[model samples]
Target: MNFDAFLHSLTSSFTPVIDSSFNPEDYIHVDLSPSNALLNQVNLSSAEDIELFLENFLRQNQKKVAYGGYLEKRSIYDRSEHFSSGSSVQRRNIHLGMDVWCAANTSVLLPLDGKIHSVRNNKNFGDYGPTIIVEHQENEQTFYTLYGHLSLESLDRLNVGVKVVKGEKLGELGDATVNGNYAPHLHFQLIKDMHNHAGDYPGVCTKAELKFYSSNCPDPNTLLKIY
Candidate 1:
């Protein structure tokens, strides 16, 4: 699918990150942009302070910043399922979503103006730490996208059926402990049918379920327009 067209179909503010002008076609194979903070500024001395700042920022601005995905050769092949298992025992089932690496509290945005179809906090290490599922309909097609690993405060005030805008800041990435015990990042994903559930959705899939998962959760770069 044309990622750019799909993105524009969902959002009007997306400007494809391009050199001269925003060209979605030219970005088909472009690398992810550099991390001005995570791999550069975040350090031990600043970890706590940065995390605190992130929390407050989310409280103030209420938006989420994206971080990791398709960075040249650094990305793990989407089909590779043999990732080293984390402490959670769920074998790191090949990252299915682009990780928005950032300090805890970085606000996450709802890419498309949508309604809260579901929301849940799967409280387990290496799990989707405090997640929200937003449902969007475009061209008669109903789809769902998930934002996982969020701050506790993000969910503190939300409930089902809440209205949100395309650029509305929905939540923030949480600290390691509350945000799935990893360097803080938002796990973003797209889903076709939620099957039947609320407050929880699978953020990862095994090889046996790859085909279904892929079809359900389309590439989010389509909406994000980030190369």
Candidate 2:
């Protein structure tokens, strides 16, 4: 099925990214684009700095959680070569996943029934630490869902080809030390074409390839239905 049909199917079946008790209203949509003033004030290079930013921002907004940052151009990637745009390839600044900011040990739930496709600990500054990609099938059309920035413990018993049900306990939100040194958050994404990549995928792409990447990775909100 196409992305539109896949999204429509969600109306009948889907799962929450967090606990069922969570309320959508409690989540504040955040902007990590270049135009955001807060980015200019805080040194995101330090995970602690991002943590501090999250704390103050959440308190001020009177919200318990902060989310968003899909397709956002982030300067935070400048910390490591993993997101390098200075080489032969074009500069990669646009983010491709939805980031959910919360407590360090908060649970990250599965959004659909699937089998464990791949798992890896992409240990690097500004990387996806302890990542997991689940392969799913809907109406005979297969797609994949990726969960990044997870606690190391989450992978202890995880293995490839293992079946996982919808809304299952996928993992917990990892701390900065194991979660690519960013603030505690979950980077959730949907991929129509993995391009043979396993255990890792480009969650961000250069502007030149935006057209293709955008179509490959549709807006996660289409399934999440949360702003």
- C-alpha lDDT score of every prediction, in listed order: 0.60, 0.86
Question: Which candidate achieves the best TM-score against the true structure?
Answer: 2
Q: What TM-score against the true fold does each predicted structure earn?
A: 0.66, 0.94
How well is each residue in 23-112 modelled by candidate 1, as lDDT tens digits?
343222212323234324434233354455444544554443323442122222222233334433444353456665555666677666
- Over 4 Å off in model 2, which ranges? 12-15, 87-89
**Quick one: best lDDT, which candidate?**
2
Q: After superposition, how far is residue 68 of candidate 1 from its true place, in Å?
A: 3.6
Candidate 2 per-residue lDDT, tens place, 102-179, comes to 888898888788999999999977889999999999777888989999999988869999999887999898998899
- Give the root-mean-square deviation of each candidate in angstroms: 8.4, 1.8
Q: Report the Cα lDDT for candidate 1.
A: 0.60
